[model samples]
Target: MDADVTDSAGTPADPDHRAGDTPQGRSQEEPGATDSTDGSEPVPQKDAPQDETPQGEATDADAPQGSGDEDKAESSDENKADREADGTGAQTWADHPKDGSASRRKRPWLRWAALGASFLVMISAGAGWWLYKKLDGNITTDTSAAAELKVYEKERPTPVVMDAQNILLIGSDSRSGDNRKYGRDDGGSQRSDTTILLHLAADRKSATAVSLPRDLMVEVPKCRTGDDKETREQFTQFNSAFELGGTACTIRTVERLTGIRIDHHMVVDFNGFKDMVDAVDGVEICLKEPIDDKDARLELPAGRQTLNGEEALGYVRARKTLGDGSDTERMERQQRFLGALVNKMQSNGVLLNPTRLYPVLDAATKSLTTDSGLDSLRDLYDLVRSMRDVPTDQVQFLTVPRQPYRQNVNRDELVQPDASELFKQLREDKPVAVVPADELKEKEKAQDEKPDDTGSDSESPTPTPTYSGSSAADDLCEQ
Candidate 1:
């Protein structure tokens, strides 16, 4: 069924020449150019023809097979007549519909279905692009300078590699850019008020979160801040690393202290945590006693209570009412609540449901500043997916070991045995089993209450609160 077309020189047909007698076409030496078909060639007409031979009859040698020259001419005339019998007969492959069927033979519904499928694909692509842009727009990304960040393939005994997985978490009061409208004090004196070190087992089956005291004094490395305009470097509290340089410097300081490479880091401001809490409806906590801390504007009664955004923030941040008024208790409370929060987020299907997930993600994105490794939406998603099924007990919490610092009345020094082992476990990636004396006592008390052990439902001596509102109490229990 293939019709072979050739040019005047008997080669394949070229676009340069066709049936219409354009200037180029008329100049071409077609086989029929020498014979007269309509008397003589028409005189040159400005738009129609110029100096070119007239269309002519075929030669005897060029006639159809098994036919005389006269018969061949007659057949040619009849074919031309048949072509004109139909309407305009000019045709090309494109003239047939895309499915290789003629327009008359195509099914109307099939064409429409194909068009609808194409439209849906285009819409899906556009939505994916928009989502990427929206999420990407909110993140502040940092990648270690490829040339500046040293990479050592040689096996060296590094702290992070020596212990379980270590991750650093920072909570900032930063009010830069759009945050100014939120009425936060993110101006000149911004410090990482809350810092946590997360330790995961070598198998990554469990984790322990340890809080670092913001008020503790530590050797701070020099750092640069501001643009070229207001940049400065100084040594102060470890928390000052954020104010001086930023997350990069803060990461460097923690790495120097623990001798462990932080695999990831996250910072959330006041509003970010608040929005996340509100989106989740709130978190539940069991408080046996009431707390009233004026600095944090907290007031609550003893017993279990569900806290809203403001109350939860107050509970985590208040230091005045917590045990011995020390930062360590505050860290413990933060860890307890954080474990609860993770459980809540997982059970609530925050990751599985897009309708619920987007708001949380939006809040987190707005509040977050991270290293370049976690800059994108995809990167954050992958990290969440990895830790989604980690058991709650596996996510343990602890405090960095410290004791009274001789240099300051209000500061601390790293404790012996416990603190060193803690760092050692982190370096070795081992699990930590820490049982506070009071918690151990409570467990023993519950065991004693078994019906067989007590023999009676009668009352026993009232148990002293291992965690009472004594001088030992930290403000973390306030609300």
Candidate 2:
């Protein structure tokens, strides 16, 4: 049978009465009832019925909907924190799920390439510096010549004009080392086989190389030798001064003879000259007739040919076989050979190519013995730089006007007024007469052929006094 349920007040209840139904019905009846009864803030009871539901059903409904959103928010916050901690906010797509990372990856390779290029440049610079030092170290200086020259510094000729330069070039024939193979190695005294006084114009437009004969008779002044031994002043051949007292005595003698100041001097030996010739590959020469000389060890058929170092030495030294056995003819041949050598060195194949330039510089510096003014590579470079722009045609070679000595037929004597005039011109820094008749004729022909295209009136350069000399621009094979 159905039992009747009553409330706590003992009143009769409905037949369907429930235990939790009373609290929910009272909450709906008076929303402020709980607050008034407790004298405190009311508790939120809107979700009380849902909270009172079965635990399994509540978890299923809430966790799948509301709680799922809360869990996703928390997970997102954690991921952001991880990214901040790892400092990967700008991570690439390859490393993370981001766009535009391919472009960023490409930049690293470019940066590395630039860095590698810079490293290579630094290495190349270091290598260049090492090469410079190596080349600079090869040069040898003559301290003895410098010290001895200092003693007579006061006696040196003063420059008549600014920028006029004079240099003495001496070819030493000392048969002690490599040169001994070429000549008698009898332990003989060294002599100046060749002597040239080079004069550079004040304007730097022209140059003149005057060859002095070794057989010329001159009065050598008393000089102190390298060993501090003094020699009495005496009359002797021009080369004898060098034998007695070395470079210092030779310089003093030259100054006394010419009355022109020498700005610097260089002494070159046989080995050095050969090496220099070889460094440039070879120098071209033209022979008018076949040469077969046992003494000079030179054998060549007549015509144009390139001469190696050994052949060059022999060709320059060949006297009795090549020409009339006169020193003057040999000097002329030397001048021609030098002109060709200069042309070869200045060519692009040698000057522009580092492979060729290094050997040539090495050979040149190793063989040179210079004065204090031009003792180092830097000094020599400066000198060369000054003359690099000089035209080949303006480079002249001549012998001092000479005649047979009155006392001895074998010796030479300076032609009176002509020699004095040449020295005066050099002293005054004036351009000497060096125009060859052939060149003059060519110039006249060119002028006659040229049409006056522009009516511009340009004044012509003053004609230099013509002298008996040849230019470096002259063909080596020309008769």
Count of backbone clashes, every candidate in sequence: 20, 1
- lDDT per residue for candidate 1 within 1-479, as digits (tens), equals 01111112133435776665333222333322432335677333233223222223233454456645444343334334544565323222233234432332447888789999999999999997897779777887655421122332122134445434566788875656644443465454566878988766666576667777776666655544545222344434567777776666676667666667777688778778877887888888867768998877789987877888788888888888866677777777777777677777877888788878888888889878776778899988877776677766556666676766777857766666656666666776755664554765687698688567456688887442222111111122344
Candidate 1's C-alpha runs over 4 A off are: 1-118, 143-165, 175-186, 225-237, 289-294, 299-302, 322-324, 440-479
Residues forming the 10-long window of minimal summed lDDT in candidate 2: 1-10
User: Pairs clashing in candidate 2?
Assistant: 433-465
* Local accuracy of candidate 2 as per-residue lDDT tens digits, 1-479: 00101111133345677764442222223332232233555443332333343222224354545554564454344445665666544222233333334445647888899999999999999998888888777766777877877887888777788888999999998888767887887665778999999999988888889888898999898888756899999988899988989888898899888999888899898878888899898888788889999888889999999899889999998898977788877887888788777778776456557788888888887777887788776787777777777888878888887877899967888988878888888888888866554775787689799997577688777565555667778778775
TM-score of each: 0.62, 0.73
